[model samples]
Target: MTPPIDHAPTTEARMLEIVFPDHTNHLGTLFGGTALAWMDKAAFIAASRYSRRTVVTARSEQVDFKLPIKQGQLVETIARVVEVGRTSMQVEVELIAEDLLSGDRELCTRGRFVMIALDSRGRPAQVQALPGSAS
Candidate 1:
């Protein structure tokens, strides 16, 4: 059975991280892989919170890097479930970078991830119907 999409607030998640030297590259910009990892983690958190079940990444949309994050900057990733299926969810995540000392923030990257909920046996499991939807 498919799950209904819930109100955005209930299935949203946010995470913060500091861009240290280790998280950047030779040019002092955040590594693409590192950014994708952060985005995926944020999506997982949101999907799990929405489904209340073990979730795994199935796939991700092409991510666009709009701005570069420099070292010493603070990064915040916001993720929310945008759609729901029988056992899968689509989460949209956006990464914002802020100057640690200036508080200036900009959107750095954005992506959508597909996560699947798993049962105890590691098979796909259904999620609850969203608010106002027929279960």
Candidate 2:
């Protein structure tokens, strides 16, 4: 039997990481490049799950690092597919930092990633359109 179809546009992906020494900069805070890598991974997972196909990051937009996440903190990344085009998905990703001891949490970074689905031959492939979307 065929699998069920998901028409909803609420597909999301979440991930958690510990800010170890390797993931931090000399200032004892999470490195910007490491944070972006984690966010991109979240976006990739979200887009792949939503499209049920292989997806690649096309671009990232408006990445704002509002707070410095200190080393030894916990980081939570949440990614959701906010829009869908003929062969692409716009995934919004946010990173939240939490103090392991006090349980304090704050939004540290946010960005939008564009992912494109690819076929077996590495060409852009059409994906299911979002509800009410013209694609």
Candidate 3:
């Protein structure tokens, strides 16, 4: 069976937006890349907030696309810190697309991102858990 969804406290914050024509495909659906970009942005924000230092994407888990997001839909991206090491933070991100007019939401994509904290010199630096962070 699929593992239970983790409902732990997220490290960073949540972001939402309504998909417009600029973010849509020729078929009038949100493109996968658009969603992926948003996920990455959300992950970066979370990691930066947790590390208190500049962070860079070290790796990205393969994205699984579950449904198509239509134009004029509201897209919500949730990102949470799942694991923290000496200098690396693992962020789990999920993108959900909702039709505000119809109140329909779908899981558009999910992925994990590994980010490494950077020092002032732009080199990998040690990271500490932020205040109010869940252990």
lDDT (CA) for every model shown?
0.92, 0.94, 0.87
| Error in Å for residue 31 of model 2 | 0.6
Candidate 2, residue 55: Cα displacement in angstroms equals 0.6
Q: Can you write out model 1's per-residue Cα lDDT over 36-59, one digit (the tens) per residue? A: 999999999999999999999999
Q: Which wins on lDDT, candidate 1 or candidate 3? A: 1
- What TM-score does each of the candidates earn? 0.88, 0.90, 0.85
lDDT of 2 at 72: 92
Residue 43 displacement (Å), model 3: 0.4
Residues 16-50, candidate 2: write the lDDT tens digits: 99999999889999999999999999999999999
lDDT (10s digit) by residue, model 3, range 1-135: 999997544486599989889999899988888888899999999998777799999999978888888888899999988888889999999988888978888888889999999999999999876456684
Model 2 — TM-score against the truth?
Answer: 0.90
lDDT for model 3 comes to: 0.87
User: Which residue pairs collide in model 2, if any?
Assistant: none
The numbered model that scores best in lDDT is: 2
Instruction: Tell me, by TM-score, which candidate is best.
Output: 2
After superposing candidate 1, which stretches have Cα over 4 Å from the reference? 1-8, 132-135
Error of 1 at 75 (Å): 0.1
